[model samples]
Target chain A: MKQAVEELRRQAAGLLKEERVKCVIGWTQGTDVARAVPFFATSVRQAARLTWTPFCVNNLSKYLLNHRYDNTPLAVVVKGCDSRGINRLVQDRQFVRERVVVLGLPCGGMLDREKVLRVVDPGAALQEVEDRGSEYMLRTDKGEYGFEKREALLSKCLECEHNIPVVSDLMIGPQVPSPAGSGIDRFAGVRELETRDPAVRSTFWDRHFARCLRCYACRNVCPACNCKECSFEQAVPGWQQGACWLSKRNHPGQNYLFHLIRMFHVAGRCIDCGECARVCPVNIPLRELYRKVMKDAEELFAMKTPGTDPEEVPLLSTYRTDDPEEFS
Target chain B: MLVSRLLEYVGLEPGRFEMRWISASEGGKVAETVREMTERIRKLGPNRKMRDER
Candidate 1:
């Protein structure tokens, strides 16, 4: 892991020094040990601060949208899951492949900060992290803490299928085995919800949606949500006579409409990066909602997972002669 | 079909939503489809799931 961090910094510095890219987006040490925040390195000195650890959880590809119109080339660091966001942007034609560099990392898994805090001191300063195949050994200024991968890894990581990035210009480190077991079912949660009665499911979703603050954190972090102008944002020129689709007042009906519309819009294009659920302040099980759409798409259209293949057309954008029309 | 499935997943009764194909020339078929959907929805009663009660 240390070697990978050193190599990451070296490559980032080289890219900046040679003027290969205007900036390199990576993670730097955050204020605490359990968090690694996104950092943009434009100079060699800034690149040296780049680091890699189990805490590097944010998907950096969405930041590419910021440079879309500038025409300035950029380099981005991606873990297995984050790499799909790049394919999503490129496939959407929102970004050009030639204008950016992809630095790939083979991720073992990322720690759930809340879970880690239970075992490690809140203020502990991390010195090093060692992956022991089954668990992570964290060396902190306070003490050493060992966390088993199954218990500490984020729920998304336990079922990850892309530990090694599908696309990359350069591989950063030796491949690490995926933490997901062979028989793990990624759609189990969605399936469970499907088996419930209609009223039960309604109550279940309402319990979560009612607490939503409508902050749009999920939309902002999503790479699949690459709209130039979101309908949720007010002051559009010609939408519903310039009125916002949903009122700013956070009513239950409006919230439900907000989530459902967003889900439908991203139905076939969602990369299943789990960023929505991760960033949700109210702890909504948003991945389950998105996966229900994915599962239905697969069962109905025999579609593959979105953003997995860069060359594949979006699910809803194209149709086949044999497409199911049972409802009609 | 996808929207119907999504609505069902979010707890709306399957009968509350429907889709049918009726060309412009098939005015009788359109009325028949609407009649069938209206009867099914009547049996299902009011859609109170996503309704704003406030």
Candidate 2:
């Protein structure tokens, strides 16, 4: 991992000197190993500051979402998951594909926060830690504790097959062989919940929806949610006019409905990066729902979102003369 | 927006399909909207089939 970090720094430094790219984006180790901060390099010196470790888990692609410029191309470092995000943005035509140079990196599943906490200092206080693969050694005054990587992997990482990136103009490291794990049926839980009566499903979601404070963090962080003017905020149509409960927008099921509709809208296009679930303050496993939609898109339509050819039509956009008639 | 764009991507000819904006309160009218769009699109034939081979 340390050697790879140095190699990444070298590549970034060289790219900065190329004069064609305006900036290179990658992750650097946070104050501790538990967090990975996004690093933007405008010069060779700044490239040295970039780093990578097991704790650098956040998807770096969202940084590219707000990136806008009239000139100067951007160079981005992407994992397999992050490349999927780039694909989504390209499909939407939000960014010109020719304007960006991608630096792809092979990924070993990132560490899960809760999993690490459980291992080191189960009840003890772990100030900081780093995953050294064999065991995660943690910083505690008493002494360092270590644990197996399996115990600390994020749910999404547990089943990741594309640890090696799918797309890149330049790739770093030997590509990883496909990941190993029992194939997860991401929709099984959703299906189980759906089997209950509609009333039961409604009851369950009401409790879930009630916890929503409407911070819009999930939407804001989602790469798929990029829109110059979102439908929810359009005043002319007033899609959810007076939608907030505290405000006078008295629309019922407004928040939940907004989320549901948005989910379906991005169904085949969602990359399942887990950003929505990770950033949600309310701890909703929103990725599971999106994953279910992703599974359905694959099984029913043979579509796999932004990972496929970017030119391929979005699933909902092209309807076959003979679409499945289960709903009909 | 998505459907129209998709048909275009697949090199399909323009059709009678219309994109409608329906509100949640107007849910009762959804069936009517779909029926109207279906009739118009069917009259246009399958949009993809109208395209020459890629």
Candidate 3:
């Protein structure tokens, strides 16, 4: 990991000094090695803060879509799953591929915070963690402990195939072999619900949507949900005005519709990077919504999204005259 | 409305297509649109056949 950081430091400094990129977005130590936060380095000095480790789970490309700074080409460090998002944006023609320079980092797998929290006490002030081959050595205020890498790994890591990155302009580190099926069965919960009657399904969704805060964190973190004006915020006939907040009967069925419509809109385009699920404060099974859509696209249209060339017309935007509609 | 208006402006030959607006307020419009569109599609024939002849 240190070797990768040293190599990235050199490359990032060069990109900044040459003004090739307006900024370089990468993870940096946040108070501790266990809490790496996204750092945007505009200068060579800032590049020194850039580091990589198992704890870097947040998809940094989402910061790029936010346009938090002035619109300029950015140099971003992307893992395999993160690269899929870049591919999706390009495939959807939402962003020009030329604007970003992706530094593909071959990740063995990232630590899932949920999994880590399950093992370590939530209040434990973790200071540093050393990657010791098979086990990670940790230093916390409570005490010191060593944990197997497998135990702390994110659920997504269990099925990761793109740990070394499928696409990047400059690659660093020797490629590591990723697992065959990193738990990509994103629709397990949804399929379970599908077996139930309509009333049962309605009750299931009612319980989940009943807890929604309407914070829009799910939509905000979504890579494919880059709309100028979201439909949920509209007034005058207001599709989802009264139903956004978390209250009984206030949310109504529109909350479910809002989710359904959004999922369908990005059906073939979802990269399944887990950003929507990660960002949901209320912890709704949002991944299940899009995962079902993705499964349908793969089965019915034989379409794989975002990772392909930009010229291929998306399934939603294009249709066939001889399309199989006889079943209807 | 957009579909009908566009087809009208283009001056398409009669029976080339049919268009309708199915509002959320109207439940029957859903079935009506589906039936009407199906009829128009049948009249126009299969799209692949039309493309091949052209």
Candidate 4:
């Protein structure tokens, strides 16, 4: 992993020195050892700051939307999950493949900071992280700590389908085997919810939605949510002919409507990056809601996961004559 | 069809929501569908899930 970091920095610096891209988006050391925050490298000196670690979990493809109108080319570092976001943007026509360089990283898995803290000292500065196949050796100023991947990995990483980037202009490191097993069922969570009574499911979702702050962090971080003007952010006056679909009140009903509408809007388009659930402050199992839609789409239309192929047509956007007519 | 499934997933009564296709010439069918839907909805009572309390 250290060699990959050095190579990543070198490549980022070379790209910037050659003037191939106006900016390179990657990750850097965060305020704490347990975190890594997004970094933009606009110069060779800044490019050298790029680092790769298990904490580099953010999907950086959503940042391309900022340069959507600008013609300047950009380079972004992507993990397996983040790479799917690239396909999502290109397929949605929100970005051009020709204008950007994708640097792919084959990820084993990302660590859950909370889980890591349970084993390592919270205040210890993370000096280095070495991947040891099934476990990670963390060298900190305090001491060296070993974290088993199975116990320390984020919940999403446990069932990751793509350990290698789906799309990339360059591969950053040698391909690492996927952490998820072939027998892992991606829809297991959705199936569990389905088996529950409708009343129980309703109560469960209601409890989660009631804690929503409507901060829009999930929407902003999502690559599929690339609309220029979101319906939730419409500023129509109260007396206007075109009224807003939802009121600004923080009522439970409004929250329910907001979540349901969001889930519907991204039904077939969501790439299952799991950013929505990760960014939620209230810990909503948003992935379960989205996966339910994906599961149904598979059962009904035999559609593959979204963003797996850029050329494939979106599921809901097209219809077939043989489409199920059970509802009608 | 997707919307119906989504509504059901959120605990809404499946009978409260229905989707049907009727041509303009099928006025009789449209009326019958509406009557049937209204009866089912009435039996299911008011929707308390997403209704605002204003």
Candidate 5:
């Protein structure tokens, strides 16, 4: 892990000094040991502050949309999941492929902070974490402790589609094997929901969406949501008679409406990176909403996973006459 | 309402929507109408509504 971090810093510095890229987007240690935040490095000297850790959870590809046309080229550090996001934007024609350099960083998996907290004593100050192949050892004020990878891994990482990258300008780190049957049964959660009685399913979703804080973290982190004027975004006071279908109310019905509409908006485009579920404070099974759409698109239209190929047109944007029309 | 909402969500051709009812005794007409609709839709190509969204 240390060797990979050293290589990343050296590469980032080289890119900035040589004018290969205008900026380098990577991860930096967060204020807390349990988190790693996104870092933007514009100069070679600032590159030293860059890092690669098991805690680097953010996708980092969403940052690329803002740099779409800053004139000079930009580079973004990406993990396996994030590369799918880059593919999404490029496929959507959001950004030209030549403008952004992709630095694919290999990731074994990421640990869930909540799981880590459960293993450690309350109020213990976390110090450092050592990544052993099978488990991660955490050093805290209370004492050193080790947790197995499976028990500590984030739900998103357990079913990781790829640990290296399908596409990369530069690749680093060792490959990690994906959990078996995870790819085939990606829609298992959605299928479970399908089996429930209509009333039970209604209650299930109602119970979850009722807790939403309307924070918009899920939409903001979503790579598929590239709208310049989102329907859910708050409008400027009185300038227009629109901009929010969600009506500012925090009613449970309104919350359910907001989530359902947002999910439908990104139906065909969602790459299933699971960033929305990761960032949600209320732990909504938001991925299941999009996954249902993804599953239907695959089965009904015979659509493959989005962003896996750059040339294929998006499913919703293009359709075949032979498309299955169950409702029709 | 749900069908229109779906069409708007995907930003597909709104008027491309089609519905026709044939009496239960007229299975041949239903099959013939479906074949004609398929040909027309295939030639129209993909929806332009998706590209022109606000």
Candidate 6:
């Protein structure tokens, strides 16, 4: 793991020194041991601050959208899931592919923040994380600790479909084989809710959404959620009286509307990177909602997961003449 | 669950929402689902869960 970090820093420094990129976006140990915040290294010297550890859970690909208009190229560090998001952005014509340099990282799962917070000392700064075959060794300023992979890894990582980026301009580490994942259905979380009665499901969702502060972390973190003028931002140019459906009121209906519209908008486009769920402060199982649409698109439309193949037509854009019409 | 919520939010009754399950081997499961949905609709009668937006 330390070798990977050193290589990444060296590569980032060279990119900055050569003027190949204006900035290198990666993760740095945050204020505490449990957190890994996005770090932007704009100079060769600043590259040394970059680190890639098991705590690097962010889909940094979304930040590239911020640099889309900049003249200088921006190099981004992306894990397997984050690279898929980059594919979505490129395929959507959000920005030209050549404008950004992709530095891929071979991921070996990641630790959940909440779980780490419970065990670590207050104000402890993370020093290093050693990836053992089936466990992780967390070395903090306080002390070194070990955690079994099954108990520590994020749910998204536990059923990770890809450990290496499908596309990469440069790789920081050698390709690592994904761990054996059995009985971990991506849609199993949704299936558990589907078994309940529809009203019961409604109640279940409402209970969760009611806790929403509408901070929009889920919206902002989503790589598929780039829009010039979001409909939720204000009254739109066209609509029923031009009022946005989303209201400032903290009503349960408003919460559902906000989340439901987001889910629908990203229906065919979401890469299932799990960033939305990860960033949500209120702990909504947002991936489950999007995965339901993903499941439906697969089963009903015979569509592949979005962003996996940029050449393929989007699921909603292309249609078969004999496509399922029973829903209509 | 999400789709049904979207519909109901806009004043459409969730009971109007539908989903299909296909299996040539499981006619009974299909019939039971339909029967259960029908019963729920009957008991609930008409849905007036719409907000008084006006």
The candidate that wins on DockQ is 4
lDDT of 4 by residue, A57-102 (tens): 8999999999998898999999988998999999888879999999
Q: Residue A27's C-alpha lDDT in candidate 2?
A: 82
lDDT of 4 by residue, B1-54 (tens): 778887888778898778888899999999999999999999999988787633
List the lowest-lDDT window of 10 residues for candidate 1 chain A: A236-245
Better of 2 and 6 by lDDT: 6
- Give lDDT per model, in order: 0.90, 0.66, 0.67, 0.88, 0.75, 0.80
- Residue A90 shift from truth in candidate 4, angstroms: 0.9
Residue A37 deviation, candidate 5, in Å?
0.7
**Cα shift from native, residue A280, model 3 (Å):** 0.8
Pairs that collide in candidate 4 are: none
- Candidate 6 segments whose C-alpha is farther than 4 A from its true place: A236-243, B1-15, B18-54
Docking class of 6: incorrect
Better of 3 and 5 by TM-score: 5
lDDT of 4 at A185: 89
Question: Over the stretch A40-82, how does candidate 2's per-residue lDDT look in tens digits?
Answer: 9989999898876656666766777667546568888887777
DockQ of each: 0.58, 0.03, 0.03, 0.62, 0.05, 0.10
Candidate 1 lDDT over A174-207, as tens digits, reads 8899988779988888999999987899899889
CAPRI grade of model 1:
medium
Write the number of the candidate with greater DockQ, choosing between 4 and 6: 4
Off by over 4 Å in 2: A118-145, A177-180, A195-200, A237-252, B1-54
Give lDDT tens digits, candidate 6, residues A1-328. 8889999999999999999999999998787777778999999899999998888889998998886766669899999888888899998887888888899999888887778778888598777788886888888889988988889889888888777886679999766667436667877776777667667766677678878888999889888888966767755455545355656567666776677778888888999899888778888888887888887778777777788887867776776888767542
User: Residue A324: error of model 3 in Å?
Assistant: 3.3
In model 3 chain B, where is the ten-residue run with the lowest total lDDT? B1-10
Docking class of 4: medium
In order, the interface RMSDs are 2.9, 18.8, 21.2, 2.1, 11.8, 6.8
- CAPRI docking class of candidate 2: incorrect
Ranking by DockQ: 4, 1, 6, 5, 2, 3
Where model 1 places Cα greater than 4 Å from the true spot, the runs are: A237-244, B52-54
